[model samples]
Target: MARISTKSLTNRASWLVLRRNRIMTIGETVGILRDNDDFLVVTHIRPDGDTIGSASALCYALRKIGKTAYLYNNPQFGDSYPWLAEPYLAPEGFEPKYTVCVDMADKGLYPEGFKGSADLCIDHHPSNSLYAKNTLLWPHKASCGEIVMELVKELCGLDAEVSELLYVAVSTDTGCFVYGNTTGETLNAASELCFAGARNAFLNKILFRTSSKARLALEAQILSSFLYYHDGKTVISVVTKEMLEKAGANEKDCQDIAALPGRAEGAFTSVTIKEIDENSCKISFRTNGLVDANKVCAMFGGGGHKMASGCTIKMNSFKAADTLADIIGEEYK
Candidate 1:
């Protein structure tokens, strides 16, 4: 109604140009840290390398600065990722004043039953709704950890430990620097991380090299049950409870193999359903650029980026698949 302050208007104009790098002002970030010394960090569910890397890296930095930091326990990720489980791992009995979720744009993305106030949300996802009270958003950055690196450098000052963790964070998000999103700035950050003592070969082996016997078995089963629908325009994969038990596979294995079908030639969309329990299933969706899987997923109460998303289904697996196909077909047509 009244005239807006010139300084305030100027700041907003500059930010629209900066776009995705629109982070909280330096003063605002300092105020957030001043409000708490102890924090617990978590990431999006079905934690990927970027989410784990960002969350754990920040945890390490907080510890180095003599602050109490903890990471959420992931029982499903289990002992296989012992290296991840040990670093700045969340304390069992520590109840912190705040929880900071790294790389998570939406609170719905957190694991079930994780109850606490969200103090801050750090991410670069364009769909973010700013759910946290204090948000440091950089939707233009290559990875969430790139934003984390800036915070560490500006707030606490960066070091070898921070850089190493962030290297994992950024590298994973860039698809080892091969993805289309890699930019000159991304490479510059990575080169500095190398100087700060990030060991690429070692981390790469730990992250991309290992596969358990169960994982291999799950792969075979997925190959066997692989299906094509819509005249090969769509792909469908079903993992029954028996198939999982026979392969000695768990949820992580299914999550690992979920993306394969989407890459098939002529397939515009892919759908994978895992029997979560008797009457419920977990559905993961992926698509080529021609299809917007997010729209299909949102019809069932889930939402994500345009090409990939997921939703849980209360109906039996067949019914879920049929219902999902109906939604997807409409968009593709």
Candidate 2:
């Protein structure tokens, strides 16, 4: 794959912004939310805590302000954080007058069979494609949850439940405040959420402190077979469909598995290539201020923050691993 120059990438992003989206400030976003009603909040496919938490918090905030809101029933939604989302799910035959997307960077991330563009997008990804009509993007923020937290504060004030949901959004994206993306603002938002009753102790125990036995087994398998390149600066882990079955792990157990390889002492970049099927694989790229994970994943038509990004390759797991290794190796060279 050809590398994209910074200038070219900027131009591409600028073109996309000029084509459709209107970038808005946090205050502007709040104003729009206040003006809207009957909202249907959407999350990306394969929803993670950040997306789910952000969407749920925003949905809950909208409702608190006397607006009708519901979360789009994402089919891929796992049972990870049911309490945050279950009550806000859109019911059958529900018609939304407006659509809002949380934590989604591009239209490619939209749920299966989702039609039309988002009326508003709240996100914190530098690589956001600006697919929404109005966007509130804070790339400097660690998580979209932070942006949503500010919006919620302005909309209806942060209640305990909203605070807890936003805390999950912020903490998960920052790896419970351990990822390189965590910043002063990230910590401050977490502190405020804690003051508002985020249940950090319980959330921490569940989200970070504890891991299922199946997850441990899966980690052991990954550790035993990690592929190192560039003198161990880069590590690649492949998770096959068979591995999940053998470990008794489901998709939920595989959450944050990409961070495992990065734990290696000398590894600066970690790539997780998960076999989706025989024809395609999902790639998660994480970096520690070395190579740009976003740029690498963007080469494969995927983009996210500089430290973490992901893409899906239309290739078998092994082949995709080799392909990503080659690209990342070139970055090191």
Candidate 3:
């Protein structure tokens, strides 16, 4: 592994507070990327569009500059993102000099058996834990892809492939530009990526407009069981293992289900409880700028972006659902 020297940095290490984590300016992050060459990039466990796209864009940009880079082939990478994920999976037994995580904030989300090994981390989650030796985090940014896009531009310039990957990263995390986290800068980044030949129309169609029948059935079940609290400001939706089995839904069907109830007229906060097993569930929280979803999830030892976040609970699904809703209701008060 190449050593990182403070002397190589053009600017001093400037740290600013972001939700208990110290964040770096883009310039300082760029300095680290410029100094390093061999990189093994990893993403969070369920590997969302932001993680996959950011890792892919970074690897492509580094290779463009004649640097060695690879992405771990996580099994959770589904067929939906082959263009962005297929070409970059590192070969088995490949030894990486530096391990870098993209769009991953919490160590709990790290790949199995690979804990506390991140040399560097890039993320946009406000609740990011400073787990990496060098963390390039900007919680105010809508997506980590936004940060990665700028870094790629500064380092190797954006090609169409990188642009497409980054577009995936930004668009998916921002709910296709409709979520509360979508800022002017987020749209500006999207515009630049489109100009750089991202197939925006095609990406939007596949990522947002299309869904499988199983997903639709799951949505119907969740809607049937949906409940509101605190005068409809807090909405709760659940998908139990039984519901999934009955609906014939796969894991892919549950994508973005957490944000569904928030689209209702009077909902200020939404929670989705997904029962992974009889004794364990994952809770996803979405808010409309009223409540801090991160804080709510943190109550259960989970964290993520403010508008969207999640935590896992080791209780039965029904109990976890009631517990999370009660906590969110209390926080609203």
Candidate 4:
């Protein structure tokens, strides 16, 4: 496996042309995998089960097929998904000949301080920025794990470990098959993974059935902070730095916190604003089909699927919540 060098102007132009031609089909992606060795898989910032599971599963599949693979040590990888990605983490100073990003929608979502571009991107986000040299995108799939499952099936048969990891990827992104984004295809893939020895019941119990005390407290604060607009159709919940402090919560405890406001019976559009700093807030938007969450998030230059999307607002949590409320409220008029 020879590494492609971009040391000269001519080689750089050639690389660009090669990349343009490499917006690949699944078969082409499989071919790339079979031909490459020494891979480094990258997860997105604020690593979730989907990103971690997909990257871990891909690394397992790659290594199973006799390729050397490791996962990039994402800075935001807290202890949230304990031990799941630890075995695959790349050692210090290891240089990969090929870089693969899984479940990442864009280069901007790359783990903090990650440099250079990916050789391949496997993602299911409709808003994918196509930042990789080669991309295998399935915008209609419920999770990037589904795409990775296909790749693994093609590369090497799915073993129990890979199946379990992919189950994590699929189930988490779809909110344990309860989110509106889940489809028949998603269920079918999950079923197949189960047949391949995925411990669905055990995984479901750990991932969904359990919650920490801090998580429960954070949910309480989020629910109490909800501000309704548009006759209860649009709800915005603010989680200030103080709220996290009060709840004894950290980022790990705040996973899926955005879904709290959307659980309100009459809310069609829900927004969760988390204070990142005094001047900036991270926004997560969810909709029950009445409004496009992607479009709403795009107002602040972010996007994802129609049912769930997110963005960052250059305002305090309260201001960002009010601003998003106004924006969502106007949609009903």
> Candidate 3 residues 1-333, lDDT tens each?
132344544454323222233345677777777678778899888878889999999999888888889988777887337568889888878788888899998777886555448778898887776777777877889999999998899888987888999999999999999989999999999999999999999999999999999988888888888877888888888788888899898887777887788877799888888888889988888998678888888877998877889899899888887787788777776
Poorly placed runs, candidate 4 (over 4 Å): 1-21
Deviation of model 4 at 67, angstroms:
0.4
Worst 10 residues of 2 by lDDT: 1-10
Candidate 1 yields a Cα-based lDDT of 0.73
Model 2 stretches astray by more than 4 angstroms: 1-19
Off by over 4 Å in 1: 1-27, 77-82, 156-160, 171-192
lDDT of 2 at 147: 91
* Candidate 3 stretches greater than 4 Å from native: 1-23, 113-116
Give the candidate order by descending lDDT. Answer: 2, 4, 3, 1
- Candidate 3 or 1, higher TM-score: 3
* Model 2, global lDDT: 0.88
Q: Which candidate comes out best when scored by lDDT?
A: 2
Per-prediction CA RMSD (Å):
5.7, 3.9, 5.2, 5.3
Across residues 115-138, which tens digit of lDDT does each residue of candidate 4 receive?
958899999888886678888888
Evaluation by TM-score, superior candidate among 1 and 2: 2
- The TM-score between candidate 3 and the true structure equals 0.90
Residue-pair clash count for candidate 3:
0
Task: Report lDDT per candidate.
Answer: 0.73, 0.88, 0.83, 0.87
